[model samples]
Target: MISFIWSPGNPLPAGTGGSENYTVGQVRELTRRGVPAQVVTVGLGTDDGRDDFVDIPFLSLPTLAAVGALDGTVVFVNEPHPVPTRRPAFLILHNPPPIREQHRAFAIEGTRDRALIATSRYAASLWSSYLDVDVSTINVVYPFAEPCFAAQARPDNRTGTTRVLFAGRLSPEKGIYTLLETLHIDVIEQDVALTFTATTAGADKPQGKIIERLLREHPAITVVTTRRTPASMAALMTEHDIVVMPSNSQYWHETFGIVSIEAQHSGCRVIASDDGGLPETDCGGVLLIAPDNAETLAWGIRAAIDSGPLSLSARRYAGMRFTVEQSVDTLLTVFAQPQPSPPATIIRQLEELILAPSVEAAHTVRVPTGTTA
Candidate 1:
């Protein structure tokens, strides 16, 4: 039996974004495998809004504390708890914990800012160097893909050379600027069109400088700022042939990219930045490009587009790599980790993780480094 005490990305099932998608995907995978999986979330998230995944009563976060404790709970959280203490718990960190100056999270729980939430060796190195702690403790569970294959391929309604799409928050750190600026004059010159999809908050925010740059230069590319319901997002992704990720953030590394997985499950090739946890997305047929470089991104995009048969290959590759059944299998392994016999093992470990020495660092806060961070 595996269950999570989680807070949604925004509490609004659909609009809340990536973390919610993760929670739903994880829960669906586990339960389908016959493991009991529960998510402790906010009140029907009614005040927050709704999504296909967040609409149910089971996903609700209980207001009572005792109920949370009764279940052999595994706390799968995106952020650090301000108050640190132990009850049977395992944390699923979305952002790498900071190892620098103390921030607000220290108030909730005594968790190391630079604590390891590694899904790979490269990520482990970043945590050790940045947080000054042993990286071994960070769990290395590769993120699971969204579980919907309802989005089958379709004929391109727009006509001309068929193309896939990249949809997400278009920010400078997200590498949209790099991809748009560096695409070959010939490639940009091509009749290939683009539809950049992002939610309303990102559209309204000041962070969209990269998107602004893309719009200013590429008239052929259309920038879409409309928010989609969960069904809409699934439909949109399935309709396209490729999904592009051009992240170029200096500090905000993508911990795990669900968008890449969504694209893959929907039978789309994913062109992504070769940074952070994106390489793990390789398991799903993601074509990696150097971070912060536009020429490379454009080159990657063009290559995926030109291969003609690459889209079908990528879709098949992703299907082999990611599955709800495999995701559940991994979770069962995490849950069966010999449950520290000493009983207080978790409490003791938290003590050490919290006490690790701090260092001078960049922004210690973890925000939107990836789809669910």
Candidate 2:
């Protein structure tokens, strides 16, 4: 039987963060299909080892990696651990490792764990370049909505001038500080009620500073720093006409930008930097912003706000392209096949796995689409 071992991350059970939704949804889908899938979680909580997916937290990730090596037919939905676990595994690349990282070898070791399943084509290219290898079978599989964006409309545009919203990490790579600098210079919030949301408290460098200045300077603007909820995200998006993501690094680039997709699904126009996989959705969503430039981001957000509300067609396009069903279907195609060759062999350019399988295949699947948070 095909098996999977996923790593635990923040923002689950609440249907909030992108990675949380992706990992949870993927586990749920495979387990529903009778595949033996279990997640290697960290923080202790009620273990939900039911159906196709099981969340077990005891296996120290480092030790689990060694055990996973012998499973021979397991899939992973996260990074590589200290040792190669389970052969024929899938390593989901979220982003390139941070620059100036001291553990470059560890990161590369992690990359060598999967057969290479990139969430976005951009991610694949970035890894290849990062590792200086031509690891090409690395395919892209997008994520689905969290079921919140699919709900009824809840607009909060108050005065109709246009609601502008910026939400995501408060890190430098997210460009929130740059965004604030531009807003400071432009005085854009004079009429429009701008709102921002992010995880605050013990946040890195610029986020805390940006939020402080934003709240102090602009009373008209509301800044919220807290754990996010699906209802909150939906309320934010539906009420606002525009959503902005100013991701700075190409590695930091959005791998299938679920937030952007979900926002559009809620009928909010998206303004995102084109550097990362955010451009890969092919959802006909997002007004692409050049990376790291305050002028371009400000301009992009301004354009989204000034433009008319998203068309029904736009929402449908995003919802259709990034749905959970489509993502899992692509993943299942690999899981149902014969055992994938060892990463060691593949890394050496061996042709065994590249060749055709002995058996013939006759089935295909078409997954459904929907809106999400």
Candidate 3:
């Protein structure tokens, strides 16, 4: 049995973000293939937010200690709790390291004795530098859009007005604020016949509520209910001509933009910020734009409107890429292999330096000829 451990206090959300979708997709695929896999949540009893995914198996534990007693390969999603496991463990780094020093220390400590997995190459490098580990030691497992996304057929014709959807969370990090600012531009609102829409994916949070209120008040943007299932989200994408992902680059770097690929799979052109893993998600229908800039975002939308709908061939190419099968195969390979050792601690490095032969000679610095002091 393989158990995917959700972070303590974070209930597994239903299709709200990449990490949640990733966990459920992986478990579903594994179970379909006759492998026993279940999501193990800590502290979130009964209300563990798997309503949309009733078919997926879930285990809710009252404490972290109960997680340590499980017999199987444990894959910790995002947060790695400092608990002893009966089998080898792995931690998937879904987000970048915390900005605070205390949280960084906690993450570093929790990472001990477990293998590291990152969602993208950029994320792997970021975590490697933060954790003081070798970049090669981290494994990359790209997220995928479910088959339903690719199966959705695009409309044969187009309407007079181009439709754009913001499928990400309503938080600032997802660049909802930047999108709001872009819609405020007179040129985008008056000159163009574009109908902008946003979903309430993250509105349960305090910050998201504030953003949601602002979105509802905006004249050009329409606030819609969040789609809780992959099929429903794909259908929503099919209804639009373009999907915008103005992800924030100031304090938050999007590790990977799953919505970009999902939109492309659903036959919608994607306009995303050209930063972090968003660039890597392109399957030929994406338009790269400057992040956090309303002007550039407006230009991107205009460009998409002018360029027209994605060609059937381009959509076909996107469907072929980033399939759930490929992702799960790579994941299984990682699970079967031996995990690399954790990064060496600072004290261990110092001890190694002290024990080295000719330690004083190792510290000697030779000055360049004719180069000063």
Best by lDDT: 3
In the order shown, what is each candidate's alpha-carbon RMSD? 14.2, 14.3, 7.6
lDDT of 2 by residue, 237-263 (tens): 786777787887644666667778778
Worst 10 residues of 2 by lDDT: 51-60
Candidate 3 residue 76 Cα shift, in angstroms, is 0.6
Clashing pairs in 3: none
lDDT of each: 0.58, 0.62, 0.89
* Candidate numbers, best lDDT first, in rank order: 3, 2, 1
Candidate 3 achieves a global lDDT of 0.89
Worst 10 residues of 1 by lDDT: 107-116
True lDDT of residue 71, candidate 1: 51
- Candidate 1 structure quality by residue, lDDT tens digits, 1-373: 4555555444534533455666666776667666677666544444533344543335554352433444554555665453232444565665654644675345225344222244555666665565445566555666655544434554455544455565666566566666566554565555345433333324545666545554656655655544445455667777666678887657678776767776777767788998887777774457888888777776777777775534566566666665656665765676666442221345578799999898868777667755665
Candidate numbers sorted by TM-score from highest down: 3, 2, 1
C-alpha TM-score for every candidate: 0.73, 0.75, 0.91
Candidate 3 C-alpha lDDT tens digits along 1-373: 8899997887888757999999999999999999999999889897887676798999999999898899989999998687888987888989988888879778988887788899899999998888888899999999999999999876654567889999999888999988988987776978657899999999988998999999898888898999999999999999999999999999899988889999999999999999988998999999999999999999999999889889889899999999899999999999998877665444577788998897355566889999996
| Candidate 2: segments with Cα more than 4 A from true spot | 1-16, 32-36, 42-73, 82-87, 156-158, 187-189, 192-220, 225-232, 338-343, 346-373
